[model samples]
Target: MIRHHPDKNLLLEYASGSLPKGASLVVSAHIQMCAECRAQYRTMNTLGGSILESCAPQAVNDKAFHRLMGRIDQAAEPEQQVTPERSKSTEPMLADAPPVVHKLLEKNPPIKWKTIAPALKMCRLKTGQDQYEVSFHRLSCGGKVAEHDHRGYELTLVLYGSFSDSDGVYSPGDFLLREPGDVHRPTVTEDQECLCFSAVQAPVAITGVSGWLLNRLIPFRPG
Candidate 1:
């Protein structure tokens, strides 16, 4: 069962199209997986539509009709854009993916997982900008992540298996938001491997004396 979710404020921002692109993507994926969030999103959209309809209408500029016609003409003869070729890796199956994520995977190459630590493998994805770094973290049974605190906001979505932190245990389809002040270490459950998608706005600051000393040498920051 899903035990966690993004807060109402973030969902409202997503519905109003005000969320940053990286954060928006994470919310969109969660909406697809959680029926409760999907219902909330639909309700928010409805309310927004009602508010817009109640607003006073403004008079169009004199050149509006000409501009509309020009746009129509351009649409009639659309330009053919070129896209990069796909690599040799097999294409990702749609399966349970949301439309946005599925389309993105179709355009890009398959994920190439890399080992970052013993029992931990990571597959990073481009967020199309430097403001956020997104990655899929895979942890083997009984694996543990170093204790750390976020420098900015961090969003984590559990995609497979389960993990536990100081707050509680998390299962698939769960959403967690960690702020700059929160600090915790995550450890995978023994039943199976845990896979999670994480998006961060800033690097992480390692906690504890040992981690702090290692951070100076290895820069244990997040993307």
Candidate 2:
């Protein structure tokens, strides 16, 4: 069972198509995995449709109408590929991973893991969005990350295995959001490795002597 969920305001933004690209992607992934969230999203979408239907229709100027028609004509043309890209190697998809994860991998292509600390590897993603830096984090069982504070807002969705921090344990499909200055050290359970998808508005503001020393070496992000 999923314990955490995206806040109602976040879901509302997603329903209204106003969420930032990276956030929208994570929300889409969560909705696919969480039945409760999926039903909520559908209800929100239905409400939006009803509201739209009740609104008074407005006259479209000739130029605007022509532009809209042009877009429709373009959308009607079907010549591009419909299949999602796959890895050249036979990389099996995770059994419980949402479709959005696969779509994201297709868009980014090639998964390369970078070791930032013992038992922890990160794969940064180029999501074509300037507002957030997205990535995947994998932590082997018994692994722990140095405690750190958020430089800005961050969202994490667990895809596999369980991890624990100051607050509570997070199992698969748990949604976590941290605001600036929130600090916590994450540790994976001993039973299995943990895999998570993360989106951050800024680089982490790490604390402690060990983290600072590590910062000097890799600095986490490329300059």
Error of 1 at 22 (Å): 0.5
For candidate 2, lDDT tens digit of each residue in 1-223?
A: 9999999998888766677777676777777778787777778878987998999999989999997675444322211222244434233424456666776777775788889788788888887768887888899898988888898878899988989998999998899999998999999999889999888887786689777777665444411
Show model 1 residue runs off by greater than 4 Å.
58-95, 210-223
What TM-score does each of the candidates earn?
0.78, 0.82
- Predictions in order: lDDT: 0.71, 0.76
